[model samples]
Target: MRWMSTVPASDCGRAGTKSSEARLQVDAWVAKRGGERAMAVRARARLVELVAYARTRSPYYRHLYRGLPSKVTELAALPVTDKSQLMAAFDDWVTDPAITLERARAFAEDPALIGRPFGGHYSLSTTSGTTGKRGIFLHDARQWAVTSAMATRMLTGWLTVRDTARIAACGGRTALVVPDDAHVGGAVMAARLRGRSRVAALSVHRPLEELVEALNDLRPAVLAPSASLGVLLAGQAEAGRLRIAPALVCLGAEGLPMAEHARIGRALAGAKVRATYNANECPFLSYSCPAGWLHVNADWAIVEPVDERYRPVPPGEASHTVLLTNLANRIQPILRYDLGDAVTVRPDPCPCGTPGPALRVQGRAADRLTIPGADGTPVTMATRPVAIVLDTVPGLDLFQIVQTGPATLRLRLAPAPGIDPDDLWDTVRARLSGLLVRRHLGHVRLERASERPQISTGGKIRPFIPATTSAKP
Candidate 1:
């Protein structure tokens, strides 16, 4: 494909010249008519432009919209796509012919390619593959710029000039706690920031003591981590084990329970706790307003809440799933893509004064498992690693790991078509056993489930479920 460098001279921080320009433009967009009417008008126009471009450049879209009208005005008339369908037609799905799935997979697999632009042209990221199949997403130069600009705007919204100056005085370093996996979105973004600014991309896979030590040494001005990890570290901070006073604590990737948010807030009394809603599919999907409502960036993206049958859901009601359309990304046309997260759009305007429909997301909920440590004390094993292991495995369809007991794990698998169940079970058991052993839970037992796993009433599959309180490690 075209591996051209699209990053501006200044890409990351609000202080950079290019970042300042982006901030100005984004500010202008928001300032016009309080950003409501202006954003809607612009989004409609951009959606039309993007649809026409996708039809002309993408073979998959061209065929998908074969008989559609030349001047389409309605978005619901278009077809909806999911991860499996898009990945199955990867070559034709992309606007560019040279960007094949094979090349993209290789690029994503290599640890050396982390943080660097793929083929020196597109910024690439992939989903966790927790739900069965992984999705590889690409962004051309223009799209990447938009992502950076939007991020800068979001960060600015959370931190004021005084906050920024205070952070800079305290070393200006950002500690990003994410999985070490090279292909994940958090790692890719962390690596890119590390290359450009004073940032430490700390892996969540590291031991708790080691992570705390590293954070203590870094004394970062900003701390970013998944919601689960943030809650764990908050406990550490409360116990005086992990000590760092960050100006801002940004949490993403997974949903943050209100209790956990309050606990973290209590632990870090002076820090600003900001929770955001985003994914690999569209990093700038939405940002949390001061009142803790997620406001969509309608100027650059569209989120359509829908029912189970793909029909549009009304405001104030929870959707079965949301359709995400990234207006900024041209290389990969993410038009009407089904993002499995359920969300609710506020019928009224946000009290925070943001000029768009506020959203409440019901995202993934994977519980952490506690197992006996070397000293027989409870050791918490975050579900992220388990998810990574399962996500990377091929030929596996729907699966779940339930911690029936302190040291017992029951695995439920729904294998892909033509796959031998016995062989798949053996492979999964071995890998899982090895991972548990490496994490110091060597005594844990793995057993195949005699019964099939059931999806929740909400139609969500949780990969990790902790044992009962009586069975605590």
Candidate 2:
């Protein structure tokens, strides 16, 4: 299919802006000769450009690339960077000397600066801090433009011009149901977009009744929520409580099981149910295909599936972890960055005819824990809030909360270096107990686990695990 081929060359180039240039490059990526050969050419070209830029501008990359050949060709030759390593050197990781880790942290911490551009030039967002370290990601005007353009193209893959017009004509309100925290990527994007159009940034942390009321009142045409909460909201829609008929329902941040997807689709009564695979590191990684596969935007971003030893995994097999390199963002060079998401690449091309690799992800499905409510029935608690509490506690690096019984929870924590485990445990227990008490789970017993938390088969450390028939203590 022809993609953006009719667009004039003048339209592609936006007054010589870097972002416009990047967008134009991405536009060309779609028009490139289809298949692996074209992808390799595009990927290599972008990689060389990014590496040269990073080595010259960023101190961290300079040091990391020291002793390496001036012109690097092999991706496997580059060193891998994880959250802990990059964050430890955050001050030197960015290309802009004006952008410091301290300043970025300060900006991210302020609720008032949620959608505001950092230093009037760059947009900022933070990771959920689920993996012990919260990542602060920044995008310059150019990078932001490219990312936005990529997103628009991905949406057009599913949505037609007519569909876009209808949403715009129908008051076009998009409800973003996520944590209210300003530091998150979704919140930051929502806040910036709010300046351009109508967007309701609803918090999942709020009471369900309040969310239902707010959504019903807003009657949004587009409903975007994390996967788990989408399931709950689907129930609300199924019960006729959430009266809004959104033209599109998008789920992100978490996994969407086939059963849950079908349930949501049925509940929405013909609304398009789509899933987007995204992270704060690279917002426009992939979008769901009509065939239900995720086609990676390899031209703008590269994701390498690696085994436990960091060797490249064969297609059709799950990777121990994925390495992501964001070609769109040059301000922060995320070259060969380790993103701990288990993914399986399709060995064959998608039936939907999209170019590039298709992926199946098994990542970040934090299970909900239930406790008896005042009505003597089980009250299901969203795992995100519970996980956030422990994640926010300084010195606690890794943790897992296992519900051993109806009123018992086992907490396993891995404290950061130099942190007192006992002290950290005390803080975690106090904060978690307070949250539980507020949610009518005060009677739940919280115990410390003697063993480290076990990683899931998919190679992820799930923060919350509900007891099941096959659960082990």
Highest-scoring model, TM-score:
1
**TM-score for each model:** 0.88, 0.86
Per-residue lDDT, model 2, residue 443, is: 82
**Alpha-carbon lDDT of model 1:** 0.75
Model 1 Cα RMSD, 1 decimal = 4.9
lDDT assessment of candidate 2: 0.74
Q: What does the lDDT read for residue 142 in candidate 1? A: 64
Model 2: per-residue Cα lDDT over 324-373, one tens digit each = 88876777888888898889999988898877679888755635666666
For model 1, residues 77-116, the per-residue Cα lDDT tens digits are 8899988898889999998888999898788767677778
Candidate 1 residues lying further than 4 Å off, grouped into runs, are: 1-33, 394-398, 413-434, 449-460, 468-473
Cα distance off (Å), candidate 1, residue 160: 2.4
| Error in Å for residue 55 of model 1 | 0.6
Q: Which window of 10 residues has the lowest lDDT sum in candidate 2?
A: 1-10
